[model samples]
Target: MKLPVLSLLVLVASCATPGGDAPATPAEMAAQARTALVHVEQPDPGSPLLQVDTAAIADSVDDAKARALLAPLLSQIADLSLARTHVSVASADWLLQCQSLRRLDVRACSRVDDAFVRAIVALPQLEELILARTATTDASIDALLASASLKRVWMWKSAVTPAGLARLAARDGLLVDAGLRPSDSSAEVEPKPEFVNLLPMPGEPALDAALVPINVNCPVTGAPVDAKRTRTVNGRVVGFCCNNCPKTFDADPAKYEAALPKP
Candidate 1:
């Protein structure tokens, strides 16, 4: 897949102007680079940090290359931010190093998981976290509470379960947005599927016509697929929003044999 651009959502906002709360000289502003970080590299003497970053990122077409491009960024940056950058597990481990970090927002980053969530709890300075519309879950919230220093957590339309919310509510000091439910889209019009039994994971968007709804659910957590959001591959087959889902069914067709709809 083509890589997306990096933004400052999870990192410090841009340096302000020098004189009017800003500096007229670009060099002066750059001096405050401590406040934020860009994916561009900075080395001594006309170094090619920028060139390397761009070039490496361009190689994201190969997953391994994408991983290599993201490796340098983690530990060195004091204020690492890659909001909506669609980070993977490796990148999350890198972000754990921003010792001075105060805010981390991975909003709309689709591939988040328990490991990344657990990693962020170690950031003592993290006061505000935004995981809106991501794959966050109840376990993630539990980890967030363990941080002790966290004051607010904004996670709208995520997978924060009712049990998870109750667990945290018992402890005061959390400003949570964990009540939202997934698959709550009451179709403005009734759906047209003949027989439906499963659905996609929350917030994972449909891709091309082939993959209207992605199924990231595990066996224990699977939900019914909504026909309105699904497209037929063959009369007996369907597609997923991401390459990651459909793993189990692919492994043993016989295991899910009975679950398949009749042709």
Candidate 2:
């Protein structure tokens, strides 16, 4: 009796045969996605300018897959535009590969840090660097100053200090935003409460008056007391040296309460 071979064929097709082509690797899948992104050409070889809108891929792929796919392609890229994405330090290998890179925009990439700044210094052709709304701190400022080719750096909302900006301004033509708190011209100055004047003990730095009332270090991070940035727990004000310190303290205020002075 001749059985229908069509059923057998359908069964074989439904089952993924091992001998048949294997599935595409993560890197390969990423490469296919990357090829569709906006590509702008420059006078350099291999069309060095690459604009990666990672925001487009964020929903589709995790960070590892994206890095594996894009890292190899950055070897010849000169200009990389990464807006609104977390570029982790593990991807440093690919960024450092851009030897001819001139302009880099990392706006709103909070994951970027001082190490990224140090790595980019190797790019001799780098001229304009935008690091707005990043976690980059004073640690990267000296490296920026040392760059012979860097012209303008925009670091608005970065952790850079006023002192660091002053040093950068001393350079002949380098431009940097002050990132200073905007003053309200229309607002009238309110008189300080008597308690405010009474808070500071005699013979301390004037700036200390604005810091939290703590003689000892922060129990959480061991940072010096900060008068300006504080959190009140159990009807007592506690000082924190860094912006994130209070968060650490708040996770379990009871744990650090013993370390704090009586209010």
Candidate 3:
């Protein structure tokens, strides 16, 4: 007797591979993670079961989701971006397990603070970190300073003060990006030069001209520097995005000077 369509479908489904509903393997977990909107890279398609090399869960991933999604692939993840997630210090335990993690981006994860930074800095291979818009302060800077493998840290918009940035920048080869340079008009000021030269001199390479600011963004506001608004400070030219930024720099030169490229 011929079976009904539903029965036939069930029969076929029953005959399918065993363990189909069993616990997922690492590769399967990666596929499932991807389905949940986590961006994962296997790096080598030829090896179908290869572990994921990179994973970005920039969505609203909290501590529980972070643990669930990353636990299976922690060993292989080299680059991870948790930017904009809701993860907090509770997720740091799993992040610390990412032994191979080289770069991490937790930018905009407001819940992440100095405690989280302290934990992740222990990752032996962590090299670059992006912590912009978080609550981390100078304590985070102190934790980051102890990381032997860290080469760059972007902490713009955090609580790190200019003094904190200077301390971190003092570390050789460590790049520190502390949001817009701070300025206080009330702070003690230096005498402005009677005549400041803003133009590149003849026969000078524009790229290397002393009047050309080494940074493309205004040190005071982190905005695109306007070539016309330039000032010579300590023999180096500094550029500002607007007339007001130069004034801001003039008010407190030392605070902004740390943001300029080191001599």
Give the number of the best model, judged by TM-score.
3
Cα-based TM-score, every candidate? 0.42, 0.50, 0.56
- Residue-pair clashes per prediction, in order, are 12, 4, 0
Clashes of 1: 12
Off by over 4 Å in 1: 1-80, 179-263
lDDT of 3 by residue, 1-263 (tens): 12442353343333233655523566565665565556777665664322332234355467866666566667878888888888889988888888888888888889989999998899999899999999999998779999999999998998888899989999998998876555765776779854323456688655445556666778998877777777787777778888898788888989988877677
All models, RMSD in angstroms: 23.0, 22.0, 18.8
Shift of residue 152 alpha carbon in model 2, Å: 1.4
Q: What is candidate 2's lDDT per residue for 82-187, written digit by digit as tens?
A: 6566675655666777776777877777787899888777678888888889888999988999999998888888888878778887898788765655586666
How should the candidates be ordered by lDDT, best one leading?
3, 2, 1
Best by lDDT: 3
Q: Distance (Å) between predicted and true CA of 219, model 3? A: 50
Model 3 ranges with Cα > 4 A deviation: 1-25, 44-59, 180-263
Candidate 1, RMSD to the unseen true structure: 23.0
| Candidate 3's TM-score | 0.56
